[model samples]
Target: MTTDRISRQDARRNAIIQAARACFRDKGLHGTSMADIAREAQLGPGQIYRCFQNKDAIVEAIIKVIISARVEHMLAVNHDLVRKADEFTRSLAGIAAFDSRDDALLLEISAEATRNPRIAQLVVEADLNLFEQGCAMLKARYPHLDTIQVNALSEVMAVLTEGTLLRRHVRPHRPIDAQCLQSNYLAILHTLFPDTQSNNTRKKD
Candidate 1:
């Protein structure tokens, strides 16, 4: 493409991506259409084509935004929680403020991946990185758990975190109460740091 044409094309592609994000936020992946995104982005249908080939291409962009946003969010952590009490409190607050819309879209995309073998592999590879991060966190806290054991625990934490967050949306009134969520997470954390718990108990005595 010519310089002017390429610049215009790049600008249009950005507009469509921005529009797709807003459309997905408002109407979800299944509900939104390419036309709707084009309208929101203020680009013509033809303009959208010069950028993304299809609606799936746009949906894939949305998925990347959802996953990358949170994955990057996690990497921002740099703190010293001197006690399980502090760590548990942080965990509860973190989970409580998580975006339910993003979670729902991610879950839907994950389910969709199952039908498309290619997408399934990509999704699994992406999630495996998150799992590895969780395992690393647990390993730092509880050095005794071997790699295999830490991996198992990390997977449990992943499942539990997602389950409770979903419950927060599905049953608003019965959402994991802050204390209950902390206590439950603490119970698991204690498994990783029995010495911390024991020392705290002794201090109390």
Candidate 2:
């Protein structure tokens, strides 16, 4: 009820979420238990239950954190891309810097979503939110593009980005060549927006 009490509750909840994320990343969803999370959070089982009803609740919270962070990153990247088409290759490379553990956790979540209705719904909602935001950014930046084209391009971009993340898990030992990724992304950009490419060339000339 008091401000301090609310702050404490918020802090405890966040601590539990962080612990759940780490546990899930290491042991995966099925492998992890509420007891594991409690140990990781340095809290008693009863204390953790005070904040979250069950392991599923903690898992959902972790997913929310991941989605929120990703949406923010996508929005930032979208803003940069709209303002600086010439720097699109650099931006692509920036987004490609993947963390192995995070990628693994994402793969785990994807697999779990196949059987977990709640997680499936959460993933669907997060994806639609991301797609809408991406579409808005693309529509604003390239008003000449028709609605269908904008939607298609946004879907392609999302697929490409997710594919890159998936690759990290598929080939954990492989080194990512930044230049190669940039070149590929630039080619995709040129194919998608040839007019912008020509305009950039003319500006440089």
Q: Write the per-residue lDDT of candidate 1 for residues 50-116, one digit (tens) a residue.
A: 7788877776666666667756655554212234334444444444334666666666667668676
Model 2 CA lDDT for position 133: 84
Off by over 4 Å in 2: 79-99, 172-177, 194-205
Error of 2 at 170 (Å): 1.0
Give a tens-digit lDDT track for model 2, residues 108-131: 888889988987887787788888
Q: What Cα-based lDDT does every candidate model obtain?
A: 0.66, 0.75
Task: State residue 173's C-alpha deviation in candidate 2, in Å.
Answer: 3.5
Per-model TM-score, in order, reads 0.67, 0.82
Instruction: Give candidate 1's error at residue 183 in angstroms.
Output: 2.8
Candidate 1: where is the Cα deviation over 4 Å? 1-14, 78-95, 114-122, 136-145, 172-177, 192-205
Error of 2 at 201 (Å): 14
Best by lDDT: 2
- Model 1 / residue 72 / CA error / Å: 2.5
